[model samples]
Target: MRQSSLTGGAIMFTGYLLFFIIMRALGLLEVVELRAINFIFLIAGVYTAISLEKKHLGWGFTYFQGLGAGIEATVLGVMPFAVFIFVYLSWIDPEFMVYIREHEPLGHYITPFMAAFVIVIEGCASGFISAYTIMQYVKAHTAHPHE
Candidate 1:
C-alpha cells in the first residue's frame, strides 16, 4: 500500500508542479478559477493509489485500506507541492504573492506558510471525500472473495 501510494503521490506531485508551472509561465496563475483543476489531479492520484494498493492486497483489500491509500497519497503528494508553492511565492515570484495578498479576502493576513497549510488541509479533505465517493463505486468490485 505504501509503495503504491508513494508512486501515485509522486505522479500527483509532478502533475501538480507541471500544471502550476505551466500556468505560471503562461501568465495564467492569477486566474483563481483555474485552481479548481488541481482537484482533478488530486482525484486521479487518490484513485491510482487506491487501485494499486487494492491490486497489491488482492483479496485483502478493504474499505479502510482504500481510504488509507487515498489519504496517504494526498498527504505525500501535497506536502512537497505546498513546499514548492511556498518557495515559488516567497522567492521565485514575490510579485505574484503580493498580487494574491491584494486579491484575497483578509489579504493582509496571508503568508506563504499559511497558504501552504491551507493546501494541506484542503488537499487532505478533498482526498478523503474523493476516496469515499470512489469507494462507493469501487467497494463492490473490491469485496473479499470469500464474502
Candidate 2:
C-alpha cells in the first residue's frame, strides 16, 4: 500500500508539474486557470494510483483502502506544486500576480499567499472528492456477495 501510494503520488506530481510547465511555456497558464482540463489530469492521477493499489493488493483492496490511497497520492503529488506556486509568486514572477489581479474575477486584491492557500484548499477538496468518487466504483465492482 505504501509503495503504491508513493508511486502513484510521484506519477501524479510529475504529470501535474509537466502540464503546468508546458502550459506556462506556451503562455496558456492564465487562459487555463481553474478549468476542467486541470481536473482531468488530477482525476487521471488519482485513478491511476487507485488502480495500481488494486493491482498490487490483488483482491485485497477495500473501499477505504482505495480512498486512502487516492488521498495520499493527491496530497503527496500536489505539495510540490504548491511550493512551486508559492515560490513563483513570491520571487520568480511577481508580475504574474499583477496579471491575475487584472484579469481574474474578484482578483483585484489577492496576494501570493492567498493564491497558494486557495490552491491548497482546492487541491485537497478535489483530492477527497475524487478519491471518494473513484472508490465507489471500485467498491461496487469488487464487493462480494457473501461479505
Candidate 1 accuracy as lDDT: 0.87
Best by lDDT: 1
Query: 14-126 in candidate 2: lDDT tens per residue?
Result: 77778778888988878754455668767877888898888888767777888888998888777777888888888999999899889888998788888878878888799
What TM-score, computed on C-alpha atoms, does each candidate reach?
Answer: 0.94, 0.87
User: How does candidate 2 score on lDDT?
Assistant: 0.81
* Predicted candidate 1 versus true structure: per-residue lDDT over 11-85, tens digit per residue: 789889999989978999879899899888888898999999889988878889888888888888899999998
Residue 95 C-alpha lDDT in model 1? 88
Q: What TM value does model 2 have?
A: 0.87
Q: Number of clashing pairs, model 1? A: 0
Residues forming the 10-long window of minimal summed lDDT in candidate 1: 138-147
Backbone clash pairs for candidate 1 read none
